[model samples]
Target chain A: MFRYILRRILYMAVTLFIIATVSFFLMKMLPGSPLKAEDKLSEEQREIVLEKYGLNDPVPVQYVRYIGGLVKGDLGISFTFDNTPVTKILMDRIGPSAQLGAQALLIGTFLGILLGLIAAISHNGALDYTSTILAVLGTSIPSFVFAGLLQRYLAVEWELFPVALWGTFEHTILPTVALMIFPMATAARFTRTEMIEVMGSNFITTARAKGVSEYGIIFKHGLRNALIPLVTVMGPMAVSLMTGTLVIEKIFAVPGIGEQFVTSVMVNDYPTIMGTTLLFAFLFVLIILVIDLLYVLIDPRIRLTGGES
Target chain B: MSKLLEVKDLKVSFNTYNGEVQAVRGVTFDLNKGETLAIVGESGSGKSVTSMALMQLLPKPHGYVKSGEILFEGEDIVKKSTRDMQKIRGKDISMVFQDPMSSLNPTMKIGNQIMEGLIKHQNMNRTNARKKAVELLELVGIPHPETRLNQYPHQFSGGMRQRVVVAIALACNPKILIADEPTTALDVTIQAQILELMKDIQKETDSAIIFITHDLGVVANVADRVAVMYAGKIVEIGTTDDIFYNAKHPYTWGLLGSMPTLDSDEEELFAIPGSPPDLLNPPKGDAFAPRNEFALEIDTVMEPPMFKVSDTHYAATWLLHEDAPKIEPPESVQRRMQGFSNTGSKDGEK
Candidate 1:
């Protein structure tokens, strides 16, 4: 097991490097230049800005310098945000984003699994139909639309949850729901379909034949096997949640990394853009690594080499 | 001996989108204590369905026992509530399914799979159940019982997994063990070993076993009495000796002739021509009339009830009617019958 974990960690490092390199070049290839945004400034101001960020150097040289600063735990400085270090700005805002993302994931996965199990067990009954409808609605409506509708009716008209902000628990509710809508829907649909398929497998029939209770058959035998497919989706789902929270954060006025990421992109703030992209890429890689490790824990059949030992 | 299980007029059907498919139609049988009764039939002949109905394990909302009286020790199990039926399952009537790999839980240790029933039904404590689980592992001839107890189903071979399943079924010492094609998924050598092990276990436990299979060779070795099923009904039933020797039903004759025998000189074995009748709109009279070569005019118009050839032997065929003309089985079947009779005489002399 220790060897397995070490191998996974080594793979994670390789994966992160590939992501960083791709993101670096991809951002450079975008239409607008970070220096071009200062067109309204005088030649002297632009020169000072270019020199300060080392952008006066060749693209390869700048890339090397950026990678060196990244390795030393530095993210240079944000061009549009009063020239503060990009890392410091991100660190300050990361807490709200992390908390919101965690809460949304927790609530979404928990309720999704619960409702999915209900749908599978009750199969073709009212509960199944209702959950299916709810999942469709959750997936169909965009997060911003969901947030807008909830803010309009649940907050504005009924005056239940606060419309916007990210301080108290009440302020986080609307944004969390909005952010969770897609993940929850995807998880529910995946889990429901997988559970239904697993429940019909021969092993479940064997369990029932052994006089194992209906609950035991469905949960103990069925759910664990069903989770293999569900686990595979979690990595991509988390990445989507982290990156896709831009619209949700804007609507709720939540000062998250996604909101900052959008702001940085609009102004072509190179340092902040690079920092947030690296952070998002790192998060995606980490989630995928965790999910890969989880495969072993959930199923003994999957070895580190991806074959039965 | 007293009857241990009596399934009378048992009928089972599945409600499909097309229509209701009558899977098992008016199947009846009795199993005596310490005896092995084999139900022989091809696939979809309602052999497995009949056994599932007896255990009340039919898939609900789609499959159900339309009508039946499954009496275990004189109590109607069919009429029992689910809560009450739980007491009988695993405790009184246990079943070993066809596929052993699927039968055993893949994730759980072999010990826990065996101990599950002992813990739940027998009310044995964890420690005691664990100890009993080891004994069961040893009982089923699994080597290195201590080490194997911790191993999962995937670790074991096919035959070994079946042994683990059988061990689980025997955990509570059920009065009747229903083995539905238990060795069907095993290799030839392993199949023999499993059958022998089952016979030994049956001797030790004296539990009446209901063995369902399509293999005639398996019936020859393990079964005491055999019931030949064709198209959702028992076409013939008798002692193993009677059915193998004086088998009366044309379907049984077809099955016997179709089977490859050790002493047969024929280059080609007989094969039954037509498929089983469609149960959605089953034939008006005999379901097997279309396939039976010796089927009479009346056989197509009226279904023949069970005709007693002896005190313990019965067959469902119009040929057995007093007024009907006598017809012998084909030349190859008669020759095989002669070979079997010679072998029977030689064995009797010993």
Candidate 2:
């Protein structure tokens, strides 16, 4: 197990390097720079601005310098943000995004699995059909549109929550809900499909033959096996929720990295762009590693060697 | 002997997309306490369905007993509510299913699997159930029972897993143990060991065993009585000696002939001629008439009633009628009948 985790960490480092290289080049390839587009200036004036940020250096030299900066735990200065260190800028925004993502993940996953379990056990009953419809709707409608609807009906019309901005628990509720719907739907659909499949498996029949009550059979034999597949989806689901919060943060006026990520991209704030991209990549890799470890814990049949032992 | 379980006209059907598939058609039999009754048949012949119906363990929304009276201890199980069946299951009756790998929950420990029924039905506390679980594992011939208690199903080999499954079935000393091809997923040597273990356990517990399997070879060793099922109906049933030596039905003869005997040196294996009839839109009369070489004219038009060949032997075949033309069983079947005695003498000599 230790060997497996070490190998995964090594692989994560390689993947992050590749992502950093690609995003750095892609940002440089874009038509714009951090300099203001308004007033025409002398050629030497342009040279002064370029030299100030080391933008005059060759692409390969800049790439090496960027890696060197990363090694020293410096993400350089954000061009568009009053020359604030990119890492400090991200640190300020990280807390809100992380908290929002965690809340949505906790609520979404729990409710989704519960809804899915209810649907699978009832199976073709009214509740099953209702959940199926709800899952479908959740997946189909975009979160921003759903966010708009919630803000209109739940906030603007009903005054259940504050209209916008991020402060107080009530302010966080609407955006958190909006962010949760898609993942919750995905989890529900995955759980429902897996639960139904697992419930009909031969082991479940054996459990039934043992005279295990319906609840026991579903909970003990059915759900545990079903959860394996659900866990596999959770890695991507976490990444999606973390990154997918960008539009939601904007609409709700939440001061998270997601909104910063978007604004950084528009103005070609290279340091912030690279920092956020690296952060997203790092988060995804960490989630997948955690998920792999969970597989070992949840199923004894699955060994750390990545095969049945 | 006292009757432990008696089934009267037990009919089971599965509601499929095509139509209702009549899986078990008016099958009737009785199991005596402390005896193993083997229900022998091909796949889809309602052998497993019969055992499932006895425990009311059929798949929901599809498979159900269409008509039946499963009388256990003088009460009809068919009339029992699902809640009532829960009490009866694991306590009054339990089952060992086919495929040991799938029968036991892969995620759970062998001890927990066995103790669950004891805890649920017998109302044993956790500590007592755990202690009894170790005892049950030892009962099923699992070595190092103490160390094995916490191991998951995947940790055990196929044969060991099956023993654990049998241990779970016997945890509460269920009145009747329904083994539905419990050894089918095991190797030949493992199969023999499991059969021997079941016989030994049955001797100790004196629980009636409903052994469902397609192997006649297995039936000879484990079964006290043999039931020959053909297309959802028991075409023949008799004591082991009667069914093996004095078999009356063509299907029984076909089954016995198909099995290889130690004394027989025949080069070509005798295979049963045709497949079992489909239960969905089942044949109008005898379901096995098309497959029976000596089928009478009336066999295709009318279903034969179970004729009493002797005090304990009954066969559902027109050939048993006195008026029907006398037809001897095939040469191969006659050889098998003689071979049984020959093997008996050989064993006696040994």
Candidate 3:
């Protein structure tokens, strides 16, 4: 078990390194130059800006310098955001994004699982039909579109929630819903399929034959096995929700890394863009690793010598 | 000789897109107290369906019992409500399935699976249930019962898992135990161990067992009386000696002849010709008539009613008609039957 954990950690480190390398070079490869944004600046000023950020050096040299600075916990300065260090900017916005993402995931997963259980138990009944329809709507409609609709009706007409901005928990309602739609749909569909399959398995028949109650057969025997596949997708689903919430965050003006990432990309802010990408990639990798560990916990079958794929 | 369970005119069918598949025809059997009745048949012979119907545990929306009266301890189980049925299940009657791995919940610990019935039907608390679970495990012949209780189903070997299943079935001291091909999935050595364990447990508990399988060898060892099912109906049923020695049904004869004998000089064992009739469009008369070598003209025109060969022996065959000529069995079969009877008598004497 210790060896399994050790291997997972080592794999995580390698994954992080790959993400950092890709993000660093990809930011450099974007078409627009960072200095070009300050078009009115004199030749000397432009040269000074390039020299300060080490952009005057070759790409390889700049990469080495950037990696060296990263080693020292320095994220350098944002090109377009009044010379602020990218790490400082990320630190300020991580809270709202993390909050919104966690809320969305929690609400989506809980409700999805509940709805899925109802759907599976009811089977061909109204609950199952309703859940299927809801999942379809959630998956088909994009978060941005959902956010826009919520802002128009729920916020504008009915006035159920604030239209934009992040402060109190009330401000999180629209954007969280927007962020939750896809994962909720995914969770519902996955749980429903898994639950139905598990319910049909021979073990369930064995359970029923034992004179176990229908509820016991479902929750204890059926649901536990059904959760294996759901848990497998949880890592990628969570990270996707957090990192991909940029459109929702922007529409709602929620101060998150997603919003920061949009601003960094728009202004060609090299340091901020690289930092956010690296952080998001790191978070994605970390969540996936955590999910791998969780798989072993949920189902011991995966805790075999080599570890799960 | 009081009947513990009686199944009357049981018929089970599944509704598919093409048509209704009649999996079980008018099958009837009775289990007496402390008696082990083996229902022997090839695959798709409806032995499992008959058992599942008795418990009212058939899968819904597709498969259902068309007509049946499963009287368990004098009450009609088919007419009982789901709630009443729950009270009967696990408490009065329990079942162990063919696949031990699939029969157990993979996610659950072996102990909890065993304790579930105790807590549900017996109203035992968690603490008491756990203690009883260890005892039950030990009772089923599993070692280190205390530590093993914490392990999941996957941790145990195939035979051990079956033992765990047996322990779970016996947890509430059920009156009737239905073992549906329990030893089919295990290796030969494990199969013997499970059979011995079951026989031992049966002696202690005195529970009537419905042992369903295709292996005649197992039937010879475990069954008190044997029912040979064909297509969906019981073609023959008798005491082990009666079935092996004075078997009346042609299907039963075919089955016995198909089995390999040590003394037979034939290079290859005799095999029953043709496959089981498709349940979707079964024959109008006897389902096994086309395959029976000794089939009479009436065998293809009408289904045979049960004919009593002795006080405890009965068979469904047109050849058993009163005016029908007395035909001798094959010499090879007679020789094998003599050998079997001699060995069985010796064992009984010992």
Candidate 4:
């Protein structure tokens, strides 16, 4: 298992390097510079400004220097955002996104699985139809639309939550819910499908023959097997939530990295954009590794490696 | 002998997209307290349906007993509610399913699988259940029972997993064990061992076993009585001797002819002429008539009643009518019947 993890970390490093390289070049390739506002400057004056930021250097040289900065754990300085260090900016913005994502993840997975179990156990019944419809709606309706609806109804009309912004726990509720819908729906659909299959498996019949309580058979045996596939689907998704929901964070004014990511890209803030992309890619690979480990944890049949002897 | 289970005209069917599938059509049988009754048939022959109906584990609300009386200890299990069936299952009646590969939950520990029944039905605490589970693993011939208990099903081989399944079924000393082709998925040598284990367990517990399998060769090893099912109905049922030697139904003859006896030196093994009839729209008369070479003219229009051959033997065949022509069983069947006796004498009851 140790060797397997080490090998995965190596692969993760390679993957992040490639993502960083691609996003760096992709950002550099875009027209219009971070100096779009400086276009009317006198040629001599523009040169001074470019030289000050080392923008006068060739692209390859800039890439090398950027890579050097990366190795030293410095994401360079953001061109926007008062020239703050990109890493510090990312760290500062992480808390709200992480909290919202974690809350949504915990509540979404639990409720989705519960709803899915009810649907599968009462298959073809009213609850099954209800869950199916809800899954379809959740997948179809965009989170921003749901955000608007939640604001209008939940905050504006019902006065249950603050309309928008990142402040109190009440303000966090609407955006967290908006961010959670997709994961919950995906979880519900997958759980329903997997649980139905698990419930029909021969072991479940064996459990039934053993006179296991309905709850025991469904929760202990059926759910454990069903959760394997659910974990697979939920892995990459969890990473996205950790990064923050771009439109959702904007709509709710949560001041998360999602808004920063967009603004950095628009102004061609190379360091900030590359840093964000790298963070996302790193989390993607890391969560995938975590998911692989989860497979071993949930199912004994899934061995990590012969190295673990 | 006292009767343990009496299934009277038990009919089962499933509601499919096409229509109602008559899986089991008015089947009747009796299981003695300590005997192994083998329900033998091809796939879709309702042998499995009979067993599932006994346990009330048929996939619902699709497969259901259309009409039946499964009398257990003088009470009809057919009328028993699902809640009541729960109490009876695992405690008084348990089952060992076919395909040990999938019958045991893969994610669960072998110990917990065995202990589940003990803790649920026997009301034993975790410690007692754990001790009993270790004993069961030992009884099933598993080595290092203590260490093996915590391992998952994947850690065990197919035969060993099947042993665990049997151990789970026997944990509470159920009075009746319905083993649905428990050895069908096992290796030939493993098959022999499992048969021996079940027989031994039966001797110790005196539990009636309703063993379902299509293998006539396997039936000879453990079954006290044999039931030949065709198209969801029992066409022939008798003692091992009656079914093997004095068989009265042509279907039974076909089944015997199909099996290869050890002493037989036939150029080719015989196969029954046609597959079993579609139960969705079962034929009018003897469901086996279309495949039966001796099918009478009246077979197409009417179903034959079970004909008594001896006190313990009966067959459902028009050939058994008193006025019917006296035609001997086919040459291949007679040769098999003779060869079986030779092998039986030589091998001393294989």
DockQ, all candidates in order: 0.56, 0.71, 0.78, 0.84
Which wins on DockQ, candidate 3 or candidate 4? 4
The sequence of per-residue lDDT tens digits that candidate 1 reaches over residues B67-183 is 978999999988988867777778888899899877776667788888878888988999999999999988899999989988888889999999998998898999999999999
lDDT string, candidate 3, A66-111, tens digits = 8888879998888777768888999999999888889999899988
Judging by DockQ, tell me the better candidate of 1 and 4. 4
- B-chain TM-score, candidate 3: 0.97
Q: How many clashes show up per model? A: 0, 0, 0, 0
Which 10-residue window of candidate 3 chain B scores lowest in summed lDDT?
B341-350
Which parts of model 1 are misplaced by more than 4 Å? A33-40, A306-309, B345-350
Candidate 4: which pairs clash?
Answer: none
For model 3, residues B1-350, the per-residue Cα lDDT tens digits are 89999989989999998899899998988999999999999999999988888778988888888997888888889898898888888889999899997889998888889999999998999999999999999999999999999999889999999999999999999899999999999998999899988988989999999999998878888888999999989999998778888888877877787777556676356678999999999897789989877777887888889999998999998788987777767666666677788776413522
lDDT tens string, model 4, B206-264?
99999999999888888889999988999999988788877889988888988876656
**Model 2: DockQ score:** 0.71
Per-candidate TM-score against the hidden true structure: 0.96, 0.97, 0.96, 0.97
Task: Give candidate 3's error at residue A91 in angstroms.
Answer: 0.9
Which candidate's lDDT is highest? 2
Worst 10 residues of 4 chain A by lDDT: A236-245
Candidate 2 i-RMS: 1.2
